[model samples]
Target chain A: MTSKQQDKDIHQYDIHQKKGFSSEEINAMSQSVLNEKLDNIDAVTLSRLHQARQQAVDAAVLRPSFLQRYWPDRCNLSRSDHPILQPLVLVGLIIFALGTGYLMSHTRTDQLNLGQGEYLANEDDLEVAEDLDFIAWLIEQDKVSDNHAG
Target chain B: MQAQQQRNHLDHFLARVERRAFHLAQLATGQTQPALDIVQDAMLTLSKKYAHKSPSEWGPLFHRILQNKIKDWYRHQSLSQRIIDWFGKKSSVRDEPDDVIQTAVDRQTPLPFERLKNEDLRQALNMAIEKLPRRQQQAFLLRHWEGFSVKQTARVMQCSEGSVKTHVSRATQFLKQQLEGFYHDQ
Candidate 1:
């Protein structure tokens, strides 16, 4: 039978088509036509789709880099597919990171200064500790003298 | 080893769905290139993120990604882009023939003359589909073309079940009206 007759046969089998307002497709005619369209996909396009699937599969198998993994938008280049915005975003992130690092280093320097201030505040205790050591030396000298005298 | 198995499973799934996905995108966009890009984008997304999900989950996820990409395309087209695509369509449809006869490889595949009758049906149906409103087209294609159940279509469309049913019913009525001649001619 011709494809038309075949399609008619398909329609005949579909009771849904008789309903005239079937929720489903007009039986399999359209779906089969669409499927035929798929079969007719040109080689170049088919190859391209195959290549796309390959690329996708490669992407699936080969792990994404840290950048692709964490920052997906950065990888897309299609925030509306501008592509120009990707570089801008990268530049923004770099500047932000540098600024954050600079601020962090400044805070660390301040903390170091605060630590030094605490040490300076303990200078009086250091002097007391030195005096205790000197007293200990004096006691030792006296004890030595007494032993010598005996 | 298990990762290899997972990759194989993913490859298998993508291969099975790729052609139909391409057709779905092509019909939605009414342009081949963006449709390819959209399908590729969808594939990339599904593989990248959802490959780890249950294989069964991939269908809805892929369709969602594809639908979202189509919506994104609709949102982003500049008028210049549309004009360019209009001109591009003429040259490409001529120069790079993605036509049925040119693409058919099997021995049993019909010649252009023999296929002419059905070609009218295909073109008419395609044009009718192209004329449909975006939501109706999407609803009909997903409901029938993609063979999704109402519930599944709703989930993919991110709409209520009632909304999906309504959309499908309206789309059905519209398509039946549009293709009335083609059916009658047969």
Candidate 2:
């Protein structure tokens, strides 16, 4: 036989020759030893240990550990409606609405009457009209005087 | 409750293995209390996580935990001692004097040496078994002491069957060499 085959044969023989417990003996001994161990271990200690372990597992299942619960805040939001952008958008819309309401009421005469509150015009408005009339009268008088001089 | 049955099974499994486990741990740690603690810690871990694991899985799992605990103990000791040594203080720790005296006495005391001499032979064999390298020791214990199959031993050792065969063969050869005097004198 080849050297490899010889080695294999020797390996096989060594195993065959090695002393080992028989299957029946092993089963009997294992069972007896296990039973003896169970008999000696404190039952109450074991029961309490079991209950505590179950409780821990239940807690983990109910609320995952910090590591398990983590989802990146950046990835959780999409472009349109992130929590950060929401408040600024709402404030901007309110400001825009207020500015538009003020401009619309100022431009309409009927709405301006309500803005005037039963008085026809405020002093600022009367001042602005008077200034316009003075400038126009000055221009007309200058035209007539220039005609007469010519 | 299903878990409870699994734990019960695990308790039984560990109980079956505890003695040899203690002996093996004792061989590695060279002390009883540390070995016992390691075995207990291993038992607790196995019962908690791998209780539902099979009988075939228990042997290796227990050993793995025991190995890890042993490593941790050594690591902690190394760091502590290194710190102490760095400060230039001589370690005041001493070996257990009682154990030394008891072993010395045991050396002189004869068992019913004539009638049950096989006990001596068994102990010699156990010592030789213990002296093997850790992997070989584990392979010997699992394959011979625990009566695991070669496949089961491989599974526990987390190695291929061929590696298991080599370890067991090397272990048996070493044991035979170590105990040849006892075996032949028998």
Candidate 3:
């Protein structure tokens, strides 16, 4: 605080004196005003604080996971030295494992489905197979003609 | 279930303390962003290191972390100020973006003394507290505002109980002097 500001504050005190406002009264007034002030803290700051609190709790609350206890550093994959790396890398790996498990499970289910569908002769496949036979005959005839020409 | 319970416990603890922690940081640092950052760092440290401890142990642990953060801020500021002084004199040193408690008096809440009903006393109290020395401010606020006992304040401040008493006594005198214009000298 500047001396000018301090002087201004002192000067303001000169404007009015709640004379003989005892030490106890000063404490009371201080408590009252401060509580009022803290209560009136801006909505934005309170919201920011709410966000910071959640983030702190999430990033720091001790779960004592196997990896966290065994590996003191929690084994980060990220090159950055950000403190949140330990939990984040753990979470990311867990999510990746879950995704891989889901895909592998779905793939087996899909293969079973394909096996069920295999005996059902699709009419389009039948038509393609007939076309393949005709194309093979045409190719053999063309080969014979080419041999003659040679 | 235990994990969820712990989380809820930690969350409630942090919520109960965040506002008071912010207020302490603001008074100590006199800058909004740094105060917020200090509170955040303190919270994170407490959560990371001591969350697994019993709930009863969290209060002193949190207070210690907060005081250390504020001290770190002071040290960092002192170093930066020294470097700036070595370089050159630029009066615009305190040109921070987020105006903290410093702006509360004039700019943020601008009410003329004439129109001041109950606000004048509040405004005067804010100014008096802001004018206090750093340690006294910390001692006074922690003791009276946070309702920590002198022994607890001493523990949080890492000082003797006698020193805590002296600091609080001096702070009370300074505050009373500043507000009531009595007991002029500290």
Candidate 4:
């Protein structure tokens, strides 16, 4: 028969077979036979299978670790390697330095102002200044009296 | 921790499918060593490349990989045979004595399935499956044995769904004819 006719025959037979037996029954039969074959595999092949499994597991373990998944260039710390983090760190350092310098300058200016104000307040001690002036006048009067006696 | 979980998941998937994968390869190649190699290669490739895929996707992905590996083996076999033929022609060897001896032995010996009159139905079924054409065997096994849907089988076979159905239909018809008595007795 021609190939096309043969194909048609096969298709017809396939339909007949399907109608004759349920698909579930055919599937179950084939599955049972295949399972039996799987169960009856030799020990040597089973050992080989175990070895293959272990090797596959090892290969998987050797793949990029979880850390590599998150930080792909973790091993490299160059600025070119970390485009985002490099600029962020640089900007952070600059901000911190500027903040520290501003704080120090402000604190020094406050200390200088406080020191000058305290010195001026001590110079403006009214009672002490008055006493000093009165003593100086008394000395002058005594000196004049001595000179007149001389 | 995540890597370990992925590995465990991959291991579980491989353990579940390796036997059936081996059987499929054996059916395709009709040899133990090549089937073993194919299964190992498929397992390793699936683990290394697709371990991060969801567990639900691993089944179809691994089957696809296994089928591709089988195809690769077929290509390699054909290429090597071509090389051998070229060398044989260069050496002006018209016929190898081994080929003649093998052909003689093959003509004398009965096929394994032909002796299945008193054998188990399972053996007869397996023999018949092994004797099927590559595409038909793949379709039958993948559809009936592995329980893949027609769409999934098409994806795995890299063929249209209609072609998958045709292959499966032809395979079922052939198998039905071969195992007619066995199924009838059942």
Let me know the DockQ for model 4: 0.15
Where is model 2 chain B poorest over a 10-residue stretch in terms of lDDT? B101-110
Return model 1's CA RMSD, one decimal. 13.0
Per-model TM-score versus the true fold: 0.62, 0.46, 0.62, 0.59
- DockQ scores for all the models shown? 0.20, 0.03, 0.18, 0.15
Find the candidate with the highest DockQ and give its number. Answer: 1
**lDDT at B36 for candidate 4?**
93
| Runs of candidate 2 exceeding 4 Å displacement | A1-150, B1-3, B52-59, B74-120
Distance from true location, Cα of B164 in model 4, Å: 1.4
Better of 2 and 3 by DockQ: 3
| Collision count of model 1 | 1
Which 10 residues in a row give candidate 1 chain A its minimum summed lDDT?
Answer: A18-27
> What does the TM-score come to for chain B in model 2?
0.68
> TM-score of chain A, model 4?
0.30
Q: For model 1, what is the error of residue A11's alpha carbon versus the real structure, in angstroms, after optimal superposition?
A: 17
Q: List clashing residue pairs in candidate 1.
A: A78-A81
| Chain A vs. native, model 1, TM-score | 0.33
Off by over 4 Å in 1: A1-27, A61-150, B78-119
Per prediction, fnat is 0.39, 0.00, 0.45, 0.38
Expressed as tens digits, the lDDT of each residue in A117-146 for candidate 2 is: 544367777777788889999999999999
Model 3, span B9-65: residue lDDT tens: 989999999988998888777777888899889988888877876787789779989
